[model samples]
Target: MYADDTVLTVADKEIEIVGRNTHLLFEQTKQYCTANDLVLNENKTIQIIFSTRDHTTTQNITLPGLENKSETKYLGITIDSKLTWKPHIDTLCKKLSSSTYVVRRMMQKGGLDTAKIAYFAL
Candidate 1:
């Protein structure tokens, strides 16, 4: 009496699925179904297919307790996980600030000597 479907395309054929405590979730969902006198028919389930330009594959994936949590990956990068922008941004800012300080010091002393300028440019 419940169903959901999703479709996505990937440039590469590699795909991965991960679940946390999947066995426990499955047990809970099964118990709920039994208490409600609902019958789960595998034959009535819809299928999910993955295909690439060169190859094809299919799988039968079930939802957990009427809800599902999945992580998506494209070209090998996980899209569902939190992306940390602060650390990288802070590092880049520090590098740029350090370079600017050096440049300003050189300009204050006189124009940058050719060797220093070349080193900084490198």
Candidate 2:
């Protein structure tokens, strides 16, 4: 029933109803956890409302304690409410740059094949 991350979805013309259903599901989940001698970690939990329409209007699921986030990293992939890939691309670029720096350092230390550097950059 659970994995490192999960994506739940419901369709409705009214966005609020979808939010409400999500809230109810969370409540039921909390109850199930309680009955099983487990606790839901509110601190690690967050909600994200996705919509192509007005972002402001999507904020209907207001649980008393949990915070909602515009972007979150789920199992290493960066996902935002707007579904933009900028964050993921930025992360990849950072790693690429760091790795390239390491390869350049290796080339400087010894006469490593220049072709290896080009290969690593790719």
Candidate 3:
């Protein structure tokens, strides 16, 4: 069995402390994976910093060996460093738009009843 899609978060008042703690935790996680006969895929791993600074300032703040991402999806929710709802709202809008299209198609092909069913199902 493989363990996957794990998320780790570290926070501190100081960026340096956060980085150091994250590094230590990452190392410990690697060791645990090794003992459990699991392989950690670094390529799929990413780090995101939550801060009020400009995006550019946070862009370079990384957790040692991991890539930094401006925004990422966790548990199907989009989160950004600013922790605003924009990203998640945008994603939700896109999904709703697609569902609207499907419902519209059902109305054209089937009827109002079919469209209502599809919309309610969604």
Candidate 4:
């Protein structure tokens, strides 16, 4: 397995690791990479020891491809768009028109307060 350059970022600190065959040196570094949201690009990766203000560190692991696909999770919103946008666009437009009609009615009734609120909310 090829070990790539590791970039450790914590808070506002950034440490770059450079060396060769680093995986044998740091065993648990892969888990650390995942926990820290560090992405390794396999295509253009290298291994090295990065000397920081504290000490020198090494990371050895074959970084996966950057283009690897993974599941996306959101707050109760599952969006899987497989080139289908017509239905979504239509629904959005319908809701918008309905809201516009409600505001128009409020404006006709001289309820400027409600109309203004609805208009701005949209």
Please name the candidate that would achieve the greatest lDDT relative to the true structure.
Answer: 3
Ranking by lDDT: 3, 2, 4, 1
Query: Residue 32's C-alpha lDDT in candidate 3?
Result: 92
Candidate structures ordered by TM-score, highest first: 3, 2, 4, 1
Q: For each candidate, what is the lDDT?
A: 0.44, 0.73, 0.83, 0.47
Candidate closer to the true structure by lDDT (higher is better), 2 or 4: 2
TM-score of 2: 0.75
Q: Give the least accurate 10-residue stretch of model 4, judged by summed lDDT.
A: 67-76
Local accuracy of candidate 4 as per-residue lDDT tens digits, 1-122: 33344533222233333223333333356666567776545455332222224332422222333321222222322222232345456666888899989899989886899799879987
Residue 65's lDDT within candidate 3 is 67
Q: RMSD of each candidate?
A: 15.3, 3.8, 2.5, 15.2
Per-residue alpha-carbon lDDT of candidate 1 for residues 21-81, written as tens digits (9 for 90 to 100): 3334445655776787766553443222223232222122333334322333334343332
Task: Provide the TM-score for each candidate, comma-separated.
Answer: 0.30, 0.75, 0.82, 0.32
| N/CA/C clash count, model 3 | 0
Residue 9, model 3, lDDT: 80
**Model 3 per-residue lDDT at 73:** 94
